[model samples]
Target: MSILFQAYPLARAALFSMDAETAHEVTLSTLQRAYDCGVTRKLMHEQPETPTTLMGLTLRNPVGLAAGLDKNGAHIDALGNLGFGFVEVGTVTPRAQPGNPKPRIFRLPRAQALINRLGFNNLGLETFIANVQRSQWRQQGGILGLNIGKNADTPIERAADDYVLGLAGVYPHADYVTVNISSPNTKNLRALQGEDELAALLAQLRDKRAELADQHQRHVPLLVKIAPDLTDAQIDAIADLLPRHGIDGVIATNTTLSRDAVTGLPHAEEAGGLSGPPVHELSLGVIAKLRQRMGTDYPIIGVGGIVSGKQAREKIAAGANAVQVYTGLIYRGPALVSECVQAIRGM
Candidate 1:
């Protein structure tokens, strides 16, 4: 634990010095190499206590490395060993494309947050699946969720096709799949969250899910990842739609465009989705609102701005059955995983 704590500042400094996008790549690459050399496997073996289950799938722990961190499924095995119960990869599109541009991701160290408009930049669906097929960490029994999205240039009118394509391609490999319409970087993508559009999209996806389950002789749960920036009315609409569309769960938030808590921070004005401490309360509010609308039985994976055991508990109390962490991991490191798990165990 002491060694892990000591590594935090050094890792932060090294990654902090580089451009945010470049630093993300560097960090994944470094982890991949460590994985290849058998280091990360050993870490997983050492962290054996970090395991839990949700949504009928067993997770190594409740805290997962969220989507966007390993968008292409490149580091699942390595990350699994890092003690995450699950590792969600990709806002993967049917076709790969370079996202926004350089300087698209910004760091707000003081706020322990990040603002990224990295518009689903990845090596496309085929490449992502190939990586997943070749992963050394297969059969770890940890939950693996593929987060699917439409390409940026894809028109919203035809966005359901992209999601269908993603569903068809990823259903066989994923423990579950997430439909990500919440990201702020994609142009007008969140408009899909509107009543008519969301209803249509989820209905089509559920139909596809039924088809795939029949074809593959299995059931793969479909989850929707929503944004923290929603109004109560918007969240309630989603809750009402979930059962009708056969959706299994909700990932209660991707990130927020709100800069409320980080108002005066260095990168406060950066144009992208804001995450970390600034989003904690707002995210909790969304979870609570969703729970109220959906009732106690609805499963929610609460994310955004979680940084401690107390915060994780707050999310559970608010309505989440499980939780995910990204910015919190960046700010607090792997020990936060164990802290959260221990806290949950106590509860």
Candidate 2:
């Protein structure tokens, strides 16, 4: 393990002492500087290369950095160096907006979890694309997935317009685009996962992708990110929509509103989505059901509550084509990336 990865406990202690969002900003800024100075290269050991293919895109490995960690795509190259097969950035929207009120993120250390209602706070689509253009992650041969969502001020009825604008703006730069409809932070965003809303959204996206494909002369895959707080019927409903709408893949789970697993833990009652070990089974259940419903060939990227390599393998065992990490990264540090890659490759 690299010295930096090994020192994560101490780093986590320091970061944990600050407010969650502040610590997040500090980490990203420090990482960007570290990468610029070539420090990350020295601190990160060579990760195992286990080439895998998903949704027609080649991944160096099956482990990915889930969206929300680097909301603006600003740290793609830096974060990618920590040994992810891919780094997905953003929940960016059509217009810039400050997210929910302060204290939006809470740490629940005893349960090894976090609850956040960040509400897609980001630098907006144009600035996000500019950051993507400035990054070397794409040229470095790492798969880059851009995740898009609707702006908060946009009414739920007109949500499609924001998504349409998002799709057109990001289609050219993304290796794949993740349509994030499952973030519990955004008001009524999870409603998009409902059958009627989901069907209409996917239909529009399918047509838009067709038009964008013609204009860009390259077909970028579209994947939908769903929530763990879904019923068996809802899971089946989503599975039925993907292929029908020409959706390329599904990211099984964003975060969960259910606190069943951490009922009395600190921050457990917080309003946002709960992530970490708490959501593991919920995510696996969704992945398993999606695989059963979509059959063997449909692409499913599993994410939610993976704090260990064993859990990473569990995602695959439950039928994930690939896996992603966000809360796991926060608690376990960079070493979790290599650990997951090795575990999944070994599988």
Candidate 3:
């Protein structure tokens, strides 16, 4: 536990000194090498049982590593070894993309938060699948969620084409696939969240999923990732459309466009989605509203601002069926996983 917990403050001190994007690459590459050489398990604290079921998938625990951190699915095995019940990867597009320019990711340590407008940078679906095939997570029964998105270069009108291409390619490799339309960095992407466009997008993917399920003789659940900036009426409208579209689940949030939580903190005015502590309340509010509208059976994977076990509990109490983490993993290290597991079960 100390190895997982105590080592981080110094490591974070070093990481925070460098540019956020550089630090991200360096850390992930290190973890990947550790995983490749078979020492990844040593980095994690063993977590207690906190089994959860969502979208017909059985998770060892409800705590998962959220999408975005392992955007290309490059380090799924290493991340899986860190104690996440599931690890969701990618906002991967149909083709490789360099994403936005450098200085795209910023840290606000005082707020225990981060803001990034990475714009779905990835190695495209082909390389992403090859990496997934090379990983040990699936062999070890770690559930995987593959998140898909349209290319930054793709026209908003053709977005469904990219999503369909992604669904077809990843369906054979994924436990589930998330449709990511909520990322603030993607230009006009959130426009898809509007009523008519959302219905059209979901309709295209639903048809593609049905075709893929038959071809693979397997079924993969599709979950939509939504934003925190939505009004109550917009959320309700989307909720009303979910079951009708055969959308199996929803991830309550990606990140927030709202900066009200951070006020005058450093980089608080950065042009990207705000994450960590600032996102918690908005995430809870979204979850509560969605849970009420989606009703008891629909799945919601709650995310945002989960720095400790108590916040994890608050997400569930707000009606999340399962929860995921990214920024908390940054602040608290792997011990956050065990802490969250313990905290949630005790509740």
Write down the lDDT that model 2 would get: 0.91
* lDDT scores in order: 0.86, 0.91, 0.90
Q: Give the alpha carbon lDDT tens digit for every residue of 142-193 in model 1.
A: 6889999999999999999999999999999999999999999999999999
In candidate 2, what are the lDDT values of residues 54-87, reduced to their tens digit? 9888998999999999999988999999888888
Error of 1 at 227 (Å): 0.7
Pairing residues by index, what is the TM-score of model 1? 0.96
Model 3, residue pairs in steric clash: 276-305
Query: For candidate 3, which ten residues in a row score worst on lDDT?
Result: 40-49
How far out, in Å, is residue 321 in model 2? 0.9
Q: What is the lDDT of residue 251 in candidate 2?
A: 97
> What tens-digit string does per-residue lDDT give for candidate 3 at 240-345?
9888989999998889998898989989999999999999999999999999888888999999999999999999999998899999888888789888888888
Deviating ranges (above 4 Å) for candidate 1: 1-5, 48-51
Candidate ordering by TM-score (highest first): 2, 3, 1
